[model samples]
Target: MYKIENLSFKYEKDKYALKDINMDFSKGDIIGVIGENGCGKSTLFMNMTGILKPNSGEIRYNDEKIKYGKKDLYNLRKKVGIVFQDPEKQIFYSKVYDDIAFTMRNIGMNEEDIKKRVEKALEAVNGSEFIDKPVQFLSYGQKKRVAIASVIAMQNETVLLDEPTSGLDPRSTDAVVDIIKNMKKNGTKVVISSHDMDLIYEICDYVYVMNKGEIIKAGNPDDVFMDEKMIKNAGLKTPWIIKIYNELKNNELKNGETKEETNLKTIKTKFAQYK
Candidate 1:
C-alpha cells in the first residue's frame, strides 16, 4: 500500500545512499529487497519509515503524499513500523513486556490498552511464555522475536524488517518466518531486506534485486531468480530451485516448463522422474 518514486537519499554531501529508487508495494504481498551490504537496503527502509527524508523524489502511502508535519509524521509512523537488523538497536528495555510496550507508552496509550496490545503482540510472536523474562537472559532467537514483538505491538499496517533472520538459527528463522506469515494472514503487509536467498524464495511473492542503490530486477521469485546474470550482478546466486529447474529443462528433460518448487523434498521427488 506504499509507492516510492524517484526516491533518493544522501547521508552526506556528494554521497547518495539511495538513488532513483522506484517500487510499488501492493496490499497482501510479501516483498523482498535483496542486495549486497551498502547497496542501500537499510537506507531505503529508513526513508520509507520517514526516519530520514529523501534528498529528492517522493513517497506516497494510500494515494496521499507523505507530509513531514509533526501530526502527519506521527500518523505515518503509526501506519508503518520498522524492526532493525540488530535486535540490540531496537530492544532497550530489560524485560520482554516492557520492551514491547515501549512504543505504545511513548504514544500515550493508556495502561489497559497497552497491556492488551503487549499481550497480543508477544503472543503473535509466540514469545508470551517469557513475557516477563529479562532481555539479557534470552537467546539470540528470543531476542529477535522480542524485536519483532515490539513492532507488532504498534499494530502498524506495513512492517519493514531489515535482515530479520540474519543471525537466527534454523528453528529461529522458521519461527520468524511463521510470524511473518501470521502477519500476512492478519493483513499486515511485510517488506523484508535479507541476504538469505532461500528464505526470500520461500516467503516473498515479489522480489527486488538491488545493486549500487538501484533495483536491477523486480518480479516474482521464479522470474527474478532465473536471471543468472542479474543475480550475479546483484552479488547473489540463483536459488537452488531455479538452478535445478534450469538444469533439468536444458538437459534430457525437454519440452517441459521449469518447476518452481522451493521445498527440498518436493524437488528431490521431481528430480526422480528424470533419473
Candidate 2:
C-alpha cells in the first residue's frame, strides 16, 4: 500500500533525523515500526503522512508519489488518518462528541451525517458511553480512544497510529488491541510505531527494526522476533513472548517428545495466555 525508497530527512544541515530508509508496506495486515526513542520512527511517519517533506528520496502511496501540494496533501490526509502518541495534542474540543466531529465539520459534512459518523466511530472504539461526557473528565485511555474515534469518523482507508497503547492500564491496552484487530477485520490497513515489543509481536504480521535513523532489519515477526541477540544489538528489547519461547526451546526435551510436538503444545499454550 505504501513504498518509501532511500528516504532521508534532516531538521538542520548535516544532522539527519532519518537517513537512507527504505520500507515497503506493500503487504501485511498490520505493519509495525519498532525503535528506541528518537530513532526516527515517528519522523518516518511524519514524512509518510506529509507532515514533513523528505530532504531526499521518494514516498509513494498506492503507486502515486506524494505531491506535497495543498490539494494533494488534503486528499492524502483524508485517506490516511494519523493518531499521535498524545491524545491531548489531537483533542481540540472539550466534549467527546465535538472532538470526534471536528474533522468532519471542517470538511463541511452535514450535521446529520457527522452525528452518524461520530456515533459509529465511538462505537468502533467502544467509547459510546463517554460520548456526552466532558473530555477533561475522562481518563487518559478514554481520551486516547476519543482521539482515535476522530480519525475513524473520517473513514480513512489507512490509519497511522503512534504509540497506540502507551501509558495505559492493562484493561485499556487490551481494549485498544481489540480495536486495532477489528480495524483489520473491517479492512482498514493499520501501521503503528511503538516501543512495546509484545504489542508488536502479538498483532503485527510484518515488522521493521530501526536504529540510528535507519531500518536495520525487516521481515515477518516470527523470523524477526526469533533473534533476541539481534534485537539487543539494535538497542531494542526482545518481545516477552519470544524470550519465553526461546527459553523453552533451549531446555532439554523430556518424555521422548518430538521437537515439533513439544513446540506446538508450548507455543499454543503461550499464545493462549496472551489472548
Candidate 3:
C-alpha cells in the first residue's frame, strides 16, 4: 500500500530528523512503529501523509509516485488519514457531529452522503452517543474517539495513528484497541506509532524499531521483541511477557521456551508449572 525509499528529512540545515529510511507496507497490514521521543516517528508519518515533504527520496502508494504538489498531495491525502497524538489538536468543530462531518464536507460529499458516512463512522468508534454533544465538553477519551470516527468516516485506504492510547485509563485504552482491531478486520492498512510496547505486541502484525532517526530493527513482533539489547538500545521496555520468558530461560526452567512462545498465557502457564 505504501513505499518509502531513502527518505530523509531536515527541519534545519544541520538538524536531521530522518535518515535514509526505506519501508514497504502492504494493504490490510497492521504495522507498529516504536521509538523514543524525537526518533523521527512523527516526522516519517507527516511525510507519508504529505503534511511535510521529505527533503529527499521518494514515497509512493500503489505504484503511483507522490509528488509535492498542492493538488496532487491533497488528493493523495484523501486516501490516507492521520490521527494525531492529541485529539484536541485535531478537533475544531463545535459539535461532535460537525467534527465528524467536517472532512466529508471538505471533500465535497453531498449532504445525504455525508450524514450516512458520519453515522457509520460514529457507530464504528462507538461515539454515536455523543453525536450531539459539544466537542469541547466531551472527556479526553471521548474526544479521541470522535477524532478516530472522523477519520474512519473518510473511508481512507490507509490510516496512520500516532499514540492512539496515550493518557487514557485502562477502559479507554481497551476501547481504542478494539476500534483498531475492527479497522484491521475491515481491511484498512493500519500504521501506528507508539511507545507502548504492550499495545504493539498485542495488535501489530509487524514491528519496526527506530533509534537515532533510523529504523534499527524491523520484523514480526516476536522477533523484534525478543532482542532485549536492541529494545534497550532504542530506549523501549520489553513487554512483560517477554521479560518473564527471559527470566525463565535464564533460570533454565523446564519448558523454558524461546520468545516465540512468550505470549501472556504461555508465560503464565510456564510460571504455574514451576510453582
My TM-score estimates for the predictions, one after another, are 0.90, 0.95, 0.92
- Candidate 3 segments exceeding 4 Å error: 253-275
Clashing residue pairs, candidate 2? none
RMSD values, in order shown: 3.9, 1.9, 3.5
> Model 3, 1-275: lDDT tens per residue?
89889999999899789999988886228999999999999999999988888888999998898987889988887899999999998999899988888988987889999999989998998888898898878899998899999899999999999999999899999999999999988989899999899899878989888898898999988889999899999999998778877876666555655434434567757756874
Q: Candidate 1 at residue 8, lDDT?
A: 89
Worst 10 residues of 1 by lDDT: 255-264
Q: Which of the numbered candidates is closest to the native, going by highest TM-score?
A: 2
Clashes of each: 0, 0, 0
Task: State the displacement of the C-alpha of residue 5, model 3, in Å, after optimal TM-score superposition.
Answer: 0.5
Q: Please give the CA lDDT of all the candidate structures.
A: 0.88, 0.89, 0.89
Give the Å shift of residue 118 in candidate 1: 1.3
Ranking by TM-score: 2, 3, 1
Candidate 1 residue-wise lDDT, 17-45, digit = tens: 88899999882379999999899999999
lDDT of 2 by residue, 94-131 (tens): 89999999888888999999999999999999999999
